[model samples]
Target: MAPDYTLDRNDELLIAVSLFEYSREWEIAEPWNAERAWFLCRVICERHGLSPSEAVLELE
Candidate 1:
């Protein structure tokens, strides 16, 4: 069995911001970083109910 968990609004926003930063850094990082970043981004998006495209959207 697994413990249940949920993200409050703040946590979700923080993760989204971090994901955005990781994406920006990915551009300047080594080519190999793209794979790792992509995987992490996908997992984050899935867990947070966010789409890959929406990950880059500006939060209001």
Candidate 2:
């Protein structure tokens, strides 16, 4: 289940950015680099109908 396109792009981008920042900060603060990280971020973006393309996916 995911959100529809009813929401504005700005709103979606904000959510995407928040999740992206949190992911980066957490990954930096801690040391956990696995596929799970990408999965979680993907879930977050999908739930909010925010495209992950806006996120800097550098989880390696």
Candidate 3:
């Protein structure tokens, strides 16, 4: 089922910034750290009731 809850502006901004940092780390960090960053990004999306794709759409 879809989540009924919605993020407020501050939460959205926080998530967006976190996502961006995670993505950056995924690109530039060592392989192990990159993997960790990727995992964290997924966790963040899941915790917020979003799929990675959905999170991207929300950022747009």
Name the best candidate (by TM-score). 3
**Candidate 2 positional error at 59, Å:** 23
Best by lDDT: 3
Off by over 4 Å in 2: 1-6, 28-60
The residue-by-residue lDDT of candidate 2 on 1-60, one tens digit each, is 887667564555555566655666677565465334556667767775555774434221
Tell me the tens digit of each residue's lDDT in model 1 across 1-60.
879988775566567567656766776665467556666767777676776667556354
Which residue pairs show backbone clashes in model 3?
Answer: none
For residue 39, what is the lDDT in candidate 1? 66
TM-score of 2: 0.39
The lDDT values for all models are: 0.65, 0.57, 0.68
How close is every model to the real structure, measured as TM-score? 0.47, 0.39, 0.53
TM-score of 1: 0.47
Deviation in Å, model 2, residue 49 alpha carbon: 12
- Model 3 accuracy (lDDT, Cα): 0.68
User: Per-residue lDDT for 1-60 in model 3, tens only?
Assistant: 987998785476467557656666667656666666667767777777876677777766
Q: How far out, in Å, is residue 57 in model 2? A: 16
Once fitted onto the true fold, the runs of candidate 1 whose alpha carbons sit more than 4 angstroms away are 1-29
